[model samples]
Target chain A: MGNQRDSIGDSSAHNIYLTNGASEGVRQVLNMAIRSKEDGIMVPIPQYPLYSALITLQGGTMVPYYLDEPKNWGLDIKDLEYRVKKAKDEGLNVRSMVVINPGNPTGQVLTEQNIREIILCYENSILIMADEVYKNVYSEGSQFLSFRKVLNGMGAPYKDNELISFHSISKGLMGECGLRGGYMETHNIDPFVEEMFYKLKSIELCSNTIGQLGTLLMINPPKRGVEADEVVDLYEKEQGEIYGGLKERAKMLTATFNKMERTSCSEIQGAMYGFPRIHLTQSAIKAAKEQGVQPDFFYCMQMVNETGIMTVPGSGFGQRDGEFHYRITNLVSPTSEMRATLDRLEAFNSEFYAKYSQ
Target chain B: MGNQRDSIGDSSAHNIYLTNGASEGVRQVLNMAIRSKEDGIMVPIPQYPLYSALITLQGGTMVPYYLDEPKNWGLDIKDLEYRVKKAKDEGLNVRSMVVINPGNPTGQVLTEQNIREIILCYENSILIMADEVYKNVYSEGSQFLSFRKVLNGMGAPYKDNELISFHSISKGLMGECGLRGGYMETHNIDPFVEEMFYKLKSIELCSNTIGQLGTLLMINPPKRGVEADEVVDLYEKEQGEIYGGLKERAKMLTATFNKMERTSCSEIQGAMYGFPRIHLTQSAIKAAKEQGVQPDFFYCMQMVNETGIMTVPGSGFGQRDGEFHYRITNLVSPTSEMRATLDRLEAFNSEFYAKYSQ
Candidate 1:
């Protein structure tokens, strides 16, 4: 227990609250953090829909910062500064910034410099909620770094800043989303806030012990040179194969999407998804309006119906005005099926553009 | 998966969202049902602290009704009626009432007629959250009926009333508090509210799948029969011995507490606790005030410090305006330790009262 608590502290100075999943953790913390109508949270524009949906449910304001699409879907420090100032100028108390690293959808890993810049911009008052659930799944050359480490290195500006970093067994080598285990580590938060969090956690009594046990198992791991050598070796080999498969498929899909007409896409730098930007023609937009849906949503729905391929629309994730995109996961199909998925995407795009584009 | 969705529908129709544990399920539905400001939730005075803490954290108002201590800790419909009316008159919208069966601390299980009478007090507009976590643990002659079933039998005032009945693996044979799996069944909820619940559930994504797996395992017990006699018999014998041991020891503890001079203790009914109401003397109360804690909280702290016994304070659970009490779970130690715990309690009570009574 002491070791676990120490690990938690090593995560962030504040208390660690475990949850059923990072999704539940995010929602609960967001609810706890934003108490009043005047309180708002700022998240990246191309963020996980979970944030906006939770913010909407909690009746908190959502301020958004657009990722720099031309800059490999990277965070623009200027945009973060602009949004923070904009929120304050508009009389919204922007309480926190939500950052997902090995970022979702865009899958861009933040540079150490970028991490420092983001922390410096926060002004030591607004808390930073760094979602590092995909920390273990980065590309071969991209080593995962904790925001805690990032802040710890920057010593002076961030030592006193409030930060909550979330990690999950579900995404790591475990690949066990069904396990639904994750923990949040908070740093530099007031003891009063930690007290409230304790009450809040007790409200759930505790997270499912099975998941917590699984997490404990993950953390402690098996002893080195233990008896079950073959079992351990097989588990490691399967994990390596899965990782290699994901990386290759991610590459292929990104290249295919980019080659398509009027379409833009990004490589999966770290996370599981590839989000491709699609430009719908005026006729398609009109048709989508007639169908009472966003063009991309309508397009995705059509693709799902036609090919049984499901993708979340950009609107689900935050997007800039009139910008359209759809997220596809590398986990969707086996390698044999990927060719079919690509062929279908190419067919649908050609057909959609032929009828709608001038 | 289909079976799970079907179960969800069955539960949703019953106004139940199965949760990671009854603790979490209770929190979610209660938060959904209670008022975050002007609305008050009526809980049994000397109730579980879980309800009060959650209500306070969610920004809801809490209205308390004292159990009729003279009537074997049964619900005093008059106290509830008075509290409800008073809260409403004071402009607090009393949204729901929480009834713990085989009461957590008090350990009193109500009769069917008593349940019906309470149900009659709250009609269609107001909901009742029935915490029947100890259904399977009742004494042989003690009957346990679902509030939903009882209300259905009554067939008039409460026939169409909204109710949520909760159950958990934490309290039954499993005693698996760490696993955190439980469920609630709902009845007579509004469609829009039902839709809102679905949306709310989606916000947490879902309870951890392993917890759901536990729930599944619970509802459909293992099919291992006489062929697997050793395993089944071992489980059965262990449970029987544990239950038998609890019943015998609970009797001993309560009998000894009642014999103590300033203590009024209740008999254990169905749940795993024995809440002995301790009457604090003037001097003890004065000393407690000087120490700056509730008399019971002070007594509990002393108990903890002196004996290394970790029991919750009655003040943590709500109580009548002037009454002081403390809760002790019967699961203190093995059968051998029962006499020692009783001796400790008796001495603690006698000395505490002797010092305080004047």
Candidate 2:
């Protein structure tokens, strides 16, 4: 059952449906819509692969909008309009826009104003799929602004816009990725369509019940007495430890990247990832091509070989032409180990550039 | 992770993958294989909904071959070849065959010889997708013989046949449907296809870990010391209780259905269900058409309304033309309540037949 929206000043959680996981929730909702290749869904470039993969798996066209790097990888309405119109011009029906706030890989949280600008752009026509799984991960300055809250902030008719916001127990402090538990909350959907969604989900009978209980434990935890206080106190203490540690690591890593010869990183506002641009030399790009790999991939592989630190290539997420980037996690435990990894990365980059530079 | 195939005499479980459930395991494999509408998969008539639902969702043709009802819902190789040839004649690429042992809805297990004929028919060409989730549920006389065992019994050439066998903790004594735990073991599959499958599964990252542990506990339960003996003793005691109760219910329900007017059920060999064929009059069929419902659906709905017992219509499980049936579980706890329900069903059938026997 889906009643998770009331706090956002919309209808209650009665519109919420538990999914197999965040990915499954996204897949089921997209599977409910996106009938043919004629229909397109907007996704962020350098997005989580699940979004793009499911789109192709469901036989729908993916219309990608790049996150603006200068603006700290924030959504620019211009890019949205460009991608939507570009897709429309090709005779594709731009039925939905997928907005992953507190972005994956990039790790930038959306502003309330940014959310408003997004909703207002296609409030009436396009369905908004907000992947708000990282909403609970509070950042340094920006508090997580749910799309439902921003939609409610617009008031009146904006609340009537079709939205399916997904939340999960997989991320955040719980980090129960293997639990495979998440939920989808829908707003302003027709009762008939809602029933249809229920029937569609029933095809697999139901999502994992234990995962549902895990989500329950998450939303409704021990809160009051000695027992409650003990659990809550321990949870908050860990949160504090991780928050302070991760925030410092984010700053140190960004500074470390900028100090490097051809590396620069945008701020890590929220989420667990830090996507840093690695400026590749022409000769390095040539070496990558000769190895039949993207420059960033080749560079990341070499870094992994040398430093024993794994990273995903920027091309894996989807970067602009001629731009090179790599995503690393803020999840590195033991501060010294993370610092050591960063130090090795710096050394490896210098060696790599010297070896492959023109 | 997929090393569960060793006990069954397959090459190894290195070719295995974990899934959300038996259904999801079946789905991922089918989704990987069935690429276009022109591609066909051989499904048993009156098969579980998962096969058809996924086949349609994955945009593949479902070519159904009927089971030999008189032979206790046994496999018929001629029917299989007929369906396959028909699909091929219609220009469909018949890529694979789906064999649900301890057949879902019907609840009949395949004989070792039956399994041999099935493999021998398509061992060279079509891939075999064996749903053996109910392999542990022993019947009155027939012990559950896995398709893998039969394939091995056929020796080398058949051993080289491509097979994807699925098993789950959802059925058997665990009966943890909502737990969502299962594994798929592939035999003699091409390495290229296995890599593709790994990439596809990587999209969702992993299945429910708690369920995975539950599966682990099932495969490697306690055996030696005091605590281990106590746990094992309790498990065996509960299993014995369920076994004694369920075996009685299966016999009772089968006899009950046979005694009822115009109703017949095959032996409840392995699975939890007893799919009974209900003979509907022509007038009832007309009435069902007037109500804009399938005849079996209408009959099952009426049965539910009259007896407060729910049964899934045969049409829901892909029944043959002109025949009507409904699938009900032998899981009605307490033999008395089941008998009372059966008595109510008998009375309802008499009254309905009196009214609709045109």
Candidate 3:
């Protein structure tokens, strides 16, 4: 717990809530922030469907801001500002904005400058929800700078800006998804609101004790002096191996997608996914329209049928109109198996393009 | 899974949903059934607060029907009829009704006749939500007849009545509260509505796999033919001891409450509670009002401070006006320890009553 607090600039125990997963924490925040249909939550266009789905479920207006895909899926603070302004102009209260640091589908780690700009864009007008579940899963050159760290470092009024940063055992080196362990740390949230959050959480009794234990283990892993040298060494070695493997797979997946015909992928800086943009021919789009499906969905269906590689269509996650993509996880194990799967996907894409182009 | 299906009258796997616990299942059902404030749910008075709390959370009107305290907390179909009629008359769509079999707090197990009468009362007009988590916990001579079983037994319209029955590993013989494992079985529900339920469930991904495993183990425990005779015997022995202990404690607590001055408790036929009504004097009520708390709460607080025994005031759970009651779990271990606790409670009650009377 002390290690957890230290990691996040001395977050008080009262401000941290252990959840079933980061998903539950996000839901709680959404529930709290969204009082009516006019309450808006700013979401990334190529976002994880969870955000859109939960926003819809909570009856909140989704003010979408598109990621600049050409700039390696980076946030454009101007786009966020415009969206919030438009939402406000349309008489919607921009209650909160979600930032998936080390992004979900479009996996680009937000730089410190990008994060600072985002905080500046929103200020204290809206709560910032930083989904930092993949905080530890960054690429070699990329770094995962937490919103809390950046906000705290920027003294006075900015530091007091309300933020809720989430982390999970399901991601990072643990990948303990089935264990359903995660937590949210609130920064500068009102005491009354925190009490309400606690009351809402208490309604569900508590997250499973096993999940809580998993969260504890994840946050406070074996350290140098706290354990036997051998134990600490083994823990560090295993963690490093997992992190390294994930990074390699992410890079390999991105490279494979980029190599495919009529497809391009931005660098997967962090997170578990490689959301590749697919360039479908007019004929292919027409065929998908005839079949009453989005082109990306049709393409994904073909890939699943032909190569047995499952991926979610970009339409499931909102995208720019007429632009198509598919979200594929880089979580396939054993480098050789992953390579074979990627190769199969490449071959299938080529044939599908050839057939559709004709 | 097969055993689970067999236990609940050949329920289809598609109709069964494993949840974090029966609480989660109940919440899901409430969410599904409650479309708006106009949608009313019939709840028992002195009910499990989960139902009332969730109903309010879902923004559904709670149509309460009182259990007959003089008749050992038995359901009065006439009372339910009156409540539903009253709600309908007031422009509420009485969509569903909740029945906690082997009741919570009240500890009443509805008889086959009561179940059949209840079905007749509602028929196809309303969905029946049977909270049967305590289906396996019942005192001798008081059999637990599931609403599903009784409904199925009555031919034609009654058999086709929409029903959702819940069970949990946290209750009964297992008492694995922290495991957070349970399930809900839907009966005669529209496939489309079921599909909607599935979609809602998918939004949360899934309940933790460990909870699901616990559910499977709970529903499909080792039987005589499935396991070695000795293993089966040992399991049965342990299970019997636990169930016997619960039953004995329930009886002891009920009897002790009955023996107390200015107190009364119905027979503890099932479940794990003895909600005893306390006869507070006018002076005590005045004192409670001055302190700005429920009379029962004031008394319970005094009991906690004096005897270190904790109990929930009946005000938290809706009770009849002018009545003061407190819910106490008959889960205190070892017969002697339970006896000692009862003795302390008796002493505290006598002193408090004497002081208040004066």
CA lDDT, candidate 2, residue B143: 73
Tell me the lDDT of model 3 at B10. Answer: 76
lDDT (tens digit, per residue) of candidate 2 on B58-111: 889898899988888998789887877788899999888998888988888887
lDDT per model vs. reference: 0.77, 0.82, 0.85
| Candidate order by decreasing lDDT | 3, 2, 1
- In candidate 2, position B58 carries an lDDT of 80
lDDT by residue (A1-358, candidate 1, tens digit) is: 2133223345433466777778878877897888777898989979888898888877889998989877778889998899889889999999988999888888787777788888888765888898888854545556666677777667776767888878777876637887778788777888898787776776666777778877676656544488488867877787677777777788888889989998988666778888899988888889999989998898898878877878899888878889899999877556668877888878987877887886
Model 3: per-residue lDDT, tens digit, B217-288?
Answer: 777778888799998999889988887888889888888888889999998888888889998999999999
Which one is best on TM-score? 3
lDDT (Cα, tens digit) per residue for candidate 2, span A183-285: 8888888889889887778777688998898778666555567466778898778878877787777777778888998899988888888899988889999
Identify the leading candidate in terms of DockQ.
2
lDDT assessment of candidate 2: 0.82
lDDT of 3 at B351: 94
TM-score of every prediction relative to native: 0.90, 0.89, 0.96
Candidate 3 deviant stretches above 4 angstroms: A1-8, B1-8
Clash count, candidate 3: 0
